[model samples]
Target: MKQKELQIGNLTLRRPIFQGGMGVGVSLGGLAGAVAAAGGAGAISAAQIGFREPDFDTNTVEANLRAMGKELQKARGRAEGGVVGFNIMVAMQHYADYVKQAVKLGADFIVSGAGLPVDLPEYAAGSNVKLAPIVSTEKSAGVILKYWARKFERVPDFLVIEGPKAGGHLGFTGEQLTSFDEAAYGEEVKRIIAKVREYEARFQKKIPVVLGGGISGMEKAARAFALGADAIQAATRFVTTEECDADPRYKQAYLDAREEDILLIKSPVGLPGRAIRNVFADRVMSGERIAPERCRGCIKGCRPTEIPYCITEALIRAVKGDRENGLLFCGADAWKAERIETVQQVVDDLLG
Candidate 1:
């Protein structure tokens, strides 16, 4: 079968492949720009993006906005005018500010998740940047669509249906994730796609539907495409790429991981996330939850006193090359990656 372009709102993606947005400093200018330059949509993850700056925790909103603009500009330069977007989590501390900043900075699109982005259209109004919501089920999709339609009189430019198999902070419960039934979820995807198509007709616009979470390799991509997905977003595979913004040691963790080592753990943010079972994870499993000396208050519902450890600190440690103490997030197939690969090679392999 021939590949098809993904048309999201007014934007056209030559390849139906999106670089899944990794948080913190993982998917930033370098990786996102490279993906875009290679003819795929590059999604810059804006979750804790300011972490790279020395005084990020104390930086003013204006300063943070300025930094975001610079990063987007740098990515655009490397993309050579290809499509570049920002993935902003709705659950972030300053969601509205980040959304406004990305739009003001000329982001081509804003793909938001971690919570229902009911007011996404409001923030994106009067901007050329397209808006997409990352949903995990038909119920979530319906809720956002209904809310947007009734309250904001808007519909998303596109939709990303993230399955339970996806890495990082997932949308499913820990037990649900372990016993997830793809047969049931596959039906849910069809229903959500149909729902979006209903709005497509009502609004006289085509709203592309993309699938994320656990999508890896050519076969998986093809399967998703066959299942009616307009595009597939891959994140874990990209982590091991040369263009990935993560530290070498971080990538090495994925390359060296085993199947059993990839397990679900509780995140301080009150969500069950998938990560490699390393020393840090072991500690969490061992019931030795220690609070960080300093609290950034990143997540909305984080309970420092009750939580085992600070997610920010552990993730930062991993990004900075502390493999033992750092939290290593990965997809189930992370162990499949045996060596470091270039971005182009990874893309081509998926496209093939």
Candidate 2:
């Protein structure tokens, strides 16, 4: 039989798959809970999840805090005692606050990225929540593991290797993304896995490594497993699922996209991101300045005046059915979505 279980610490995931957290109201309670109940590790994105709350414009931080609890409660209710996690970006303002809150709410895992989550263990200290960091290169993997081992005397429960083809803010540079080579990245993943082993030896524990980015189907997943991955993480594949929280229009964007429609653009948060070719992306590429009316203050270093457009607004629009004006972030293979399926269907198709 194929190895179909992912073990970390005392937890065993029957599906050996992670529903990569897609945000801006994309993967929330419905999709996450559905995937978890289907025997996979379901994840929710904690980025501006409160934008739907009425007071988000006025009390942004408070709105988000409330939403964190609200969504987790909903997910827990729907999960049917299955495992559920959150994807909280390290670039968000009050980053550690979200981590601490998620743990308090009984979130089983917290997957962090968009920056080196060096101090994640600080916030998750004394909690039952497992911590994992997203890294795309061996250097980053080594730095993060070495830092955690020395400072907290802890290692990641698992590692998420996000390759270049993933959506939203990526971990690679523009130069690196354009010249992306699959074989080279496979080698990089192996190197990153080696770094994880070094820390695993130091801590005397098993640290599973998961491969992410453009892995949309079984073929790619099998390749990762062959390369020694304990499991795989995927976000774009879930976007078109019926249980996904994003508006139907957002899901349509994935169904309507072409392979050539995927483009790399700079996020105001100071990183390169992958998105579909739409009016919003075109405007950004054409240097049309879409100024922000007010700062919701999401990311830490984002200066309202410095960025061309308000990322929060664009994403908010994306999730609320404003397709033409919103940023549709997706993996390079998003065009492969034929129709919206159930969350269970997606998990079954990927891992069955």
**Winning candidate number (lDDT):** 2
Worst 10 residues of 2 by lDDT: 1-10
TM-scores for the candidates:
0.96, 0.98
Candidate 2 residue 349 C-alpha distance from true site, Å: 1.7
State candidate 1's TM-score: 0.96
Give the range of the ten consecutive residues with the poorest summed lDDT in model 1. 58-67
Model 2 score (lDDT): 0.89
* lDDT of all predictions: 0.84, 0.89
lDDT of 1 by residue, 233-315 (tens): 99998999998989999998888898899999988877888999889999898889677867776777877787789887888
Error of 2 at 26 (Å): 0.2
Each prediction's RMSD to truth? 1.5, 1.0
